[model samples]
Target chain A: MIATRIIPRLDIKGPNLVKGIHLEGLRVLGKPEDFARYYYENGADELMFMDVVASLYERNSLQDIISRTAKELFIPLTVGGGIRNLDNIKSVLRAGADKVSINTAAIKNPDFIKKAASKFGSSTIVLAIEAIKQPDGKYFAYIDNGREYTGLEVVEWAKRGEELGAGEIVITSVDREGTGIGFDTELIKSVADAVSVPVIAHGGAGKLSDFEEVLKNDVSAVAISSILHYKAITQFQSQKDKLEEGNLEFLKSGKKYSKIEALTIQEIKTAIASKGILTRN
Target chain B: MTVNLKQVVIVDYELGNLFSVKHACNKVGLETILSFDKREIENASAIILPGVGAFGDAMDNLNKLDLAEPIKDFIATGKPFLGVCLGMQLLFEESEEFGAKKGLGIVPGVIKKFPKEFRNKKMRVPQIAWNQIEKPENVDWGTTALKGIKDKEFMYFIHSFYAQPIDRSDILTITNYNDFEYCSAIHNKNVSAMQFHPEKSGEIGLKIYDNFKNLIV
Candidate 1:
């Protein structure tokens, strides 16, 4: 089932979860724990923390955030960035966070994914990718926060991560992040089409309609910060419900909502054709 | 009023997250103690094994603390004992996922490596991420613990090579992929094992632990 996940992507720049695009360009926001707790209660499928530190902070402020988050929130948390070694992954996971996501580290050491998965579990590891749309229409996975191109194809790496035992693949469009231009549909479809593990689409969600569009492309989740960051989207809890009502297939949260099945690709297309779906503003 | 006896002892293997496991038991209105002491485990009514980490390291800690034999004897008494993921795998004879290490051998199986088969399958081993699951059959769904939950309900799962139960009757539920029909949950009288982390599986996961909490035979 396509589980509609509301994930708050927090950009951590020492102690505080800052937000920005590519590299060290981050603006200070509220404390990570406070933001995490808000999302936890309001309805978040899961949470992901992107460590903006170049993997070299004296004190692991991001870790401090994770430790704090672990105390207040009971939901699963995926901490990424600067996770170059097994020890980096272990520290946060041991602090009570559920999963540890690695991007550049996994690329530098393909063995990282395999080791972490075998040591921990595949579910506890996520391989983060940012694919840039080339002039040739092929998406190349970028690393080091989009500063350098890994020169590897998105589909190939996805297959590799799965082989390496990466439980899930979070594919973000580096070209689209914070641009709010809209998510890279063809790129997501390509990666999602390549691997069976769940795929999360990040970058360029300017409106709620964008979420619908991405889910329509068959991504397991639509991750947003800007739209929800402002009063533009009055509520986040209803995001999941809206997807359910629109006939998109999703995984159930179990306790809180009615056990309605999410719409799969065939179901979604059929619903659209049969006038059972609409573009709600 | 929870003036009742504490029916379960959530064994803290010291890898991580002991209280979360204990808290799940508490939500079910069952009394549970976080015990690292050998004395308390032997005296407790039931046992819970909760852990998260490397197989070899976890086994090392369990061995160093010298709590291994006591745990085995406690389970031998036929009281309800539940193991989550690494905790469950540790109940086996040996694990090949890492170099080569031994488990408690409480269950007559060796933790082998994830088959080269997954190398060609859609499922990535170290099966991280949440996925669909078939409803557990051995446990009664009528209990309030599984109140809103139904068959084929989805729960979070994270692991690589799943335990292949020697006794077919011991298999409780399963999830499938291209060529994988993983043994999701297992049970043998008073002993229950889950490949998924019930403590981290969100509410449905928490509910399973709650069911385990109320399971006072």
Candidate 2:
């Protein structure tokens, strides 16, 4: 049984995970490594460490924070921000990072995705598309934290991103981010329907039901940072046991081992061989 | 009844996606090694054969890397060999894509494409969407990953072709789109598989992987 994932995106400033409001005024929540492990331990499927300042920071912060997150954090970590050229990507990858995310730099030079794909392959490169839905219900691309408008249609840009070579697209509703209004499932369906690669639906996750609405589609993955950050929803609970008993397949498979009887990854195996889990469902 | 620790090595063929399975085992604190070495594969508690992408290329890569032999021998030992997607298809005798190429032949079937008629105009052939999962009534994953997601529940799927499994009992989970029920997972003593990318599926996905790792140990 393969699992769909829930990943937490941490915007890092230097060595710590920081959260900002509308791309301004920031506050330190916790260390990137600690928060990363916390999420992984708590039931986060994977992690995204956006070097929010990697592009803006005077120093790349490549070696220090990302390396720390990679070495200490464990679970797959995707690092992005200020990644302009291939050298930057190579530098971070060498530092134990699993994937590299690019935004402003990629928009400026579309060829970046192609080159990275050629080397690391499409699976390792995640293209972050920041979109703002206009008054007319059309989406226009926004860069630098929604300041500058690229005037590019969201769907067209997404297709080009896939053609240029990207493993996944994290299409975030800029207005919906951090609002807890629930994800824009319609927007996500359009983008996911338009491309073959994986799509990570971000922005506006108010509750588990919101997750249920988005999960209704076959997008690649879903990323919820604020909802998890604010403690709106708990990641993997005994829900699988309940789902299994409830006779629901989708709900049962994602039961994290962490939540199931405090077994290590290895013990989870032994537990299975012994038929410890009651087959009631 | 049970298996020992550190005896299994997940054969990393480097041709398809091994991250989800490998990462899941690692997360559950399982000490499984990821390798293409023959010695390691032959003497393991279990072997996870995971792959994605074109079948021809995958078989080509496995042959080029000289893994076909050891992989077959590994299955002969009957110590649990789990194939995912392309990896699962390789267990069959042959594949229909890019000409009739040979596969590992552990299972008795060939890989084929999906039928191109759908109730929804946009429901396309690749089966690329989250649909309901139909749990296998007979086979129970005792302490397994499928624990989280239940029947008629959804997981992510993205592929044009799929395996029409030779052994009906092997099919563990299926996803219903229109009139058809596509097999999403399979299990046959010492061998199991899932067409979906579980590692990428989030918490529920990890739970599934953790259960798979438990099977290995």
Candidate 3:
């Protein structure tokens, strides 16, 4: 059996790592490189750098950051957001990203998935679906960080992504994201069951049990941002002077987010392992 | 620490992560050159065939650049050659990916894909996760680059196809995914290859590179 991966998702806005509630009210955390290095040292299975505002900006600004991190860090680095055409994927991969996650582009032109997979190989292409739960209990795919609706059902889109040769699928729940409650396991389970590709559960990870809860739904990995970010802020002191982009108020204040528990990657993995779940030590 | 003058020649076929491999080598204090030049590859003290794309495209690039013979010649010199991921798969006779594509045939084997459904249980292809590498029974890792590495150590893997060496003696490590066991690494004299990306496996991965750097005579 493949060991379940514990990935720390770092949502990037401009140059700084940021966190928000329900993917809104964005707050700058610190330089992404600092957080990335910390997570690597602490045994994160993989690190995801998602440009949360890339779609709106119409370009990805992660090349410099990805290249810098890939120089010393030796692990799978996945970059998502604003990846549209083959050139965009190629450039990011050349910039040292192991995989490129596509959302808005894939949703607009479904064939983009096929083109990317064929060009860069399926293993290098990840289908990132941002899903927002509807009032009718169904999940709909959203774009631009849950600002635009694609009108495509989450489960069906996942199946199509698999058919188009996506090696993995990351299902992010907009409703439960950043709430510190838990993962939207129902949405995760629906998508996981609809496709054979490895599914990465993102959004709504607040505590150790939240990770455990999501892993039980046949998901291959869990991408935790808030829980890991909160833990990191308390442990490591960022170079505040170097960061000039994004909101630095919360980070400079040194006040912790009271809602979520800060837990290290190792601690979470240990907790999962105790539950008989296989994780890389 | 004395600076080792030896350099590893990482083949640049435009299909693999050459930068990370070179960076890892440099981190371990080994100089490296990312090149597809035939003469440069043949003359290097050590060679690393790092790849991460489809088998057909990799082979095509190798042929296009006329690197197929030089790589074989380098291995023939017994100067330490390491094949990573698709690079390891390219050493086989042929691969079943996108049809039967010919490989470098350095090692006698065929690259086969992981079954989509094994024993009625759906298996996730492209096994993109950290899986443990175990020394096969009667295989002592002390002789190979995996020396000093613990048994069942996890390594990052991202591939849908795996190698099946015709000679059992070449098999270095075995990894089981979804109850399917397959060869994860191979050792044939001076030629060594692994299915996992040692450069991307964290500190343990650096240890592997360190071992490889030491292997250079």
Quote the RMSD, in angstroms, for model 2.
11.0
What TM-score would chain B receive for each of the candidates shown?
Answer: 0.84, 0.85, 0.97
Task: List model 2 lDDT by residue over A1-281, tens digit each.
Answer: 23455678777776555555555455445455555666766655467877766666546765677655553444566787888888887777767566778778778888988987766656668888888899999997777766679988889989998888787788888888766677888788889889866688888765545666776676656776655543312333332233212223323343321211221222222332244321111
lDDT of 3 by residue, A90-186 (tens): 8898888999999989999999999889888899999999999899988999988889988999999999999998999999998888888899999
Local distance difference test scores for all models: 0.67, 0.66, 0.90
- Candidate 2, backbone clash total: 40
Task: Please give, as one word, the docking class of candidate 3.
Answer: high
Q: What is the DockQ of candidate 2?
A: 0.06
Q: What is the DockQ of each candidate?
A: 0.30, 0.06, 0.80
Question: What DockQ score does model 1 reach against the true complex?
Answer: 0.30
Predictions ranked by TM-score, top down? 3, 1, 2
lDDT string, candidate 1, A54-118, tens digits: 45553466777776666556567788888878788778776667777788888888998998887
The interface root-mean-square deviation of each model, in the order shown, is 4.9, 6.9, 0.9
Best by lDDT: 3
